[model samples]
Target: MKFYDFGDIIASDTEFVIFGIPWDYLSSKDNVNSSTAPQKIREVTKDLALTTEMGVEIPSLKVVDIGDVSIDPTNIERNLREIKDFLIAIYNQKKDVIPVMIGGDHFCTFPVVKTISKEFIADDNIGVLIFDAHLDLYDKWDKGVYSHATVSHRIYDLDQFNKNNLLIVGTRDIDIPEMKIANEKGINHFDAFLFSDLGFKNLSKDIVAFFQNSRIKSLYVSIDIDVLDPSIAPGTGYAIPGGLSYRELWQLLRLLAKNFKIIGCDIVEVSPNLDAPNKMTSNLAAKLLIEFISFISN
Candidate 1:
C-alpha cells in the first residue's frame, strides 16, 4: 500500500521522504488523467522485489512514505501553495532528508523544485535536471502560464535557476516554438537520439561533467515518465516514438548520484488509464524511484 511498505512517519534516521501531488488539471491532454498516478505507482510497488538490481536490500533504506498532499484539482494556485507547504513540513522534520515526490503531472514538479530550492543555503550551487520527451518550455499554454506545458518555463523563471544550472535531457518530441525558446535562451538539452551516437557511459559522463563545469554541487531531478521509450513505458499522456531505455536512464541516475548531492527529485506524467494491461509503466515508475533512492542512499 505504502511505497515499498515504508513507514508513514519521518524519523531521525529517515534519509528520504516520499509524497504525492494528486493533481493533473494543468496537463494539456483531454482524455488522459495522470492524477491517479501517485497511488497507482504505489499499488504496483506491492509486487516488486525487496532488493535493487545491484543487490541493495531496499527494506534497509531509510525512506518513509508520507502519502499524498491534499489537492483541489481545479485550484492551481492553492494546489501550488499546498504542495510547497507540504515539502516545507518535511524539511521542518528533517532538514537533510531527501524528498522524493510522485506526481499528478509534470506541472507538479514546478512547486516541488521551487520549495526545495528555497531550503538550500544561499551559497549552495544548486541545479535542476529534467528528463522528458518534450520541452515544456512554453512561456504560456492554454491561455495561462501555470499549465503543465509551461512547467519548465516556470522553473526557469525562478531566481535561483538559470541556463547554466538547468538541463533537459531525453528530449525528442520538441515543438518549433519550444525549440526557438530554448535556442534563444541558451538552455541546453540532449535529444534522445544521441544515445545511439554517444553510447550510454559517455553520455552519462557528459551529463555529469555538465554540472561539474557549471560548479553545481547539488541537484534536483525531475523525470517525466514519457522520457522512457513508449514501448516499455507506454502509460504516459505523450507516448512519443524515441526516448531513453530504462537501462540507459538507470545508468545515468547512478552516475549522477555518485557525482552530486541529489537534494530532491520527482517522477511524473504516468497515465495509468492509458497503460497496457500489465501496468508496466507504473511498474517502471516505481522501479526507477526505488532504484534512484537506493543510489542516493549509498
Candidate 2:
C-alpha cells in the first residue's frame, strides 16, 4: 500500500520513498513469515492520523510507496542484486528521496547498507545506527556468509563503511565471537541497561555529539523489531527480554531525525505469524515509522 495514498499530493520529486523486501531465506530462525511484515505494517497504519503528537505534520509530505522488491527466496545472490539495483535506480532518479524500507529479515539490511555506503562515496562520514538485540557482527553463521546474523560483519568489510562509524544500540544478545569482532573492529555499542541509566535526553545528546565529533553527516538507521521487549513486539523471529521500551525507541528516532540527515532506513523482523490477534506488534511498528517520517518532514 502507498504510505499515505494522498491523491492530490503529486509532484515530480518526492522527499521520502517507502518500499519493501519480502524474502526471508537468510533468516536462520524458523517461521520465516516475516516476509508478510510489509503488508501487515501497512494495514495497521490505516487508522493513524496525519500528524504526530509533536505536531509534526505528515499530510503535506511528498512520499510514495513503490511496493516490494521482486525477490526469490531460493536465489539469495539474485535477491541481494535486485535490492541493490532497485535502490541505486531510485537514488539516481530522485536524489532527494530518502528510501524507507520494510524488511523481510535483518539480512535485508546488508544490501541496503552497501548501496547507501557507495552512494555517498565522497567521505567516510556515512554512519550506521542499528537498533537490534543481537550484535549481528558474526563473520558467518550456520556456514552462510550472508545470513541475518552476519549483517554488521559484511557491512564493516565494505570499503565505504568505516568500523568506527558503526553504532549498535539496544543490544543485549551477543555471542563471544561477535563481541570479539566488535572489539577488534572498534565498533561502538550501547545496551538496554546503559540506555535506561543514561535516560533518553542524555543518551540522545551523547549520540549526537559522537556523530558530530566523528563528522558523520549522513546516516542509515536499521531497526530490528526484536530490539523492543518481546512483550511489546512479540512478532519477531528472535525475542529478547529487557529490550528498549516503545517510548524509548520513539524518542531515540526523534532525536536522530532532529539531529542528523538520515539518508535511508529499514524496519525489519516483524513476523506477523508470531503476533497475537490484536496485531499490536504491527501497530507499534507502523506508529514508529509514522512518527519517524513525520519528524523528518518537520
Candidate 3:
C-alpha cells in the first residue's frame, strides 16, 4: 500500500484519523483540478486555530494525517476498487476508529457509500444525512457511469443497501426532472424552503423526526461544503448562490450528534483555489469537523 503511515494510529488509541482523497475528476470548473485538494488544504491548515474563542479545549483525539489512497482518475474502475479497500480497512477494524474523510470532489462519495453499505449494512440498511445544494443524481454522464454529478444516485445503485433511509436537507438547486428522480428513489428532500417557511425550530424537529422514523441505526453524513452560502464558503468548484449559514449548520450538527449514532461521515468539494485571506474554506472545514467530532465524543 502506497498510503502514508501514521505508525500505530490504530494501536495507539486514536478516536479520529484524517484521510485525504485528492481527486475530483468531473469538476465543472476545470477538468481534473481537484487532484490537488489534499495538498492545498494541508498547506492552509498550517495557521488554523485549534481551539475556539469560547474556550472549549479541543480533545486530545489522536489525529494522524494519513494521506490519500492510490488511484489514477483516468481509470475510474481501478480507483473505485482501491478506495473501497481502503475504507473497508477503516470500517472493518475490530477496534473503534471513526474516519473523518476530507475530499477531492463530490464524486468521491460513491466509494464510501459502497464500502460502508456492504461492510456494515449488508443485511440491515444504513441511513444518511446528505447536506448539499444540488440533488447530485444524474442518470448518466459522458456516456459513462459514475461522475461527481451522480453520487447520490450511486448510494442506491447497490441492490442490498438501497432502502429509503436517506434524509436530504439544504437542497435548493435541483432541476424539475431531478426532483422527480429523487422522488422516484423514495428520498424525502427537506428543501431549503423549509428553513424559510417552517423556521429552524420546526426544521430542527423535522431533522430529529427523520432519524427517529428510520429503521436504520447508523447514520453517515456526507456534506458537500457548498451547502454553506457562497459568501462563507467560496472554495468549492460548483457553488450555489444561497445556502445554509454557518451557525445554522452548527445547530443542525448539534442536533444530529445528540439524536443519532453517526457511524462515519465526510466533507467533500473543498476547493482551496477559491479561498480568500487565510484559506477560509479549509480552516472552516477543519473547525466544523472538529466540532462534529467533539459532539460525537460528548
Candidate 4:
C-alpha cells in the first residue's frame, strides 16, 4: 500500500510523498477539482513498483503518497499559514526526503514555495524550476499580491530565491511585455514552440547543463500541468496548444530524476471540470506521478 487519507502519516518514510493541497478556489478563474487531483493520481500510481508501463523503476528509494494538507476553504490567510506550517514541520523532519504535491491552484504555490524556501533560514538562496506555459509574473498588487497570476512574484519579493536560481520552461503563449521582462531579467524561460523548432533533444541537454552549473544547493519544481499540450492534457484550468507531449515532458522527468536534487514539486491547474472521455489531463498527471515515483524509487 502506497497511500491513504490525510492525517494518517506517523513518520515520513518515503523519499517522496503526495502533499496534496485541495484549495482550488485561489485561481484567478477559480477552477474546482484540480484541488482533488492528488487523490485521483495516487489511486493509479500506488500499485506499481520496480517498473512502469512508461519505463523502469528507480532503485533504493521508497516513494509513498502521504495524502494532503487539509485547507480551510473559508479563509485564505489561515489556509496559507496552515499549509506553510504543515510543510515546515514535514520539511524540518526530513532532510533528504523530497515533497511532491498535487495542487489546489497556482496561488497555493505561494505557501509551498514559502516553506521550501525555509531551507533558506540558514542560506537565503534556492533555485526554482517552473514547468508551465504561463509567465505567472504578471504585475503585482493590482489584486494586492493575492492572486494566482502574481504568486511567483510574491515568492521572489520574499528574497529567498534569486534570478540565477530561477528556470521556466515551455512558455509558448506569453505576452510581449512578459517576454521582455523574463528575458531582460535573466529568467531561464524556454518557449515551447521555439524549443520544438530548435529540437527538444538539444533543449534537454541544455536543461541538464543548466542544473549542473547552478550555484544553489537545492531546488523546488513547480509544474502547471498546462505545460502539456491540450491534446494530451485537456483537464487543466489553462491549456495551450503547441505544448510538450507527455513523452517530451517525460524526457525531462528522466533527466531531472538523475541530475537535480529537487527538494519539492507540485502539479497544478488540473480542473476535473474539464474531464473528457479519456480524462486525458488527469490521466497524464497520474502518469507523471508514476514517473516521479519511478525515478525516486531509484
Best by TM-score: 1
Clash pairs, model 2 backbone: none
Clash count, one per candidate: 0, 0, 0, 4
Candidate 1 error regions (>4 Å) = 121-123
The candidate that achieves the highest lDDT relative to the unseen native structure: 1
TM-score of each: 0.98, 0.94, 0.89, 0.86
Query: Candidate 4, residues 1-298: lDDT per residue as tens digits?
Result: 2432223453555567567888776676744577777666555454335456554644333655566787877587899888877777775766566777788778888788887776433544467888889888766534456767776666666666656677788987777766776767776677787666778888888876675576665667788988988888888777789888898888787787777666778888888778675566667786776676676454
| Arranged by lDDT, best first | 1, 2, 3, 4
For all candidates in order, the CA lDDT equals 0.91, 0.84, 0.73, 0.71
The order of the candidates by TM-score, greatest first, is 1, 2, 3, 4
Quote the RMSD, in angstroms, for model 4.
3.2
Tell me how far candidate 2 lies from the true structure as C-alpha RMSD in angstroms: 1.9
TM-score, prediction 4: 0.86
Question: Which ten contiguous residues of candidate 4 have the minimum total lDDT?
Answer: 1-10
Candidate 2, 62-89: lDDT as tens digits: 7788888998887988888899998887
Clashing residue pairs found in predicted model 4: 58-297, 58-298, 59-297, 59-298
The digit string of per-residue lDDT tens for model 3 on 1-298 reads 1112233355446666667777777565573355666666666555555554345555454556567888786778898899888877765653356676778788887787777767665436468788999878777766356777777777757654453677778988897776788778776778887897999779989887776776666778888888898888888876687799988888888788887777778888888777776678777777677778777764
Clashing pairs in 3: none
- Regions of candidate 3 where Cα sits further than 4 Å from its true position: 1-8, 52-54, 91-94, 121-125, 160-163
- Per-residue lDDT value at 254 in model 2: 84
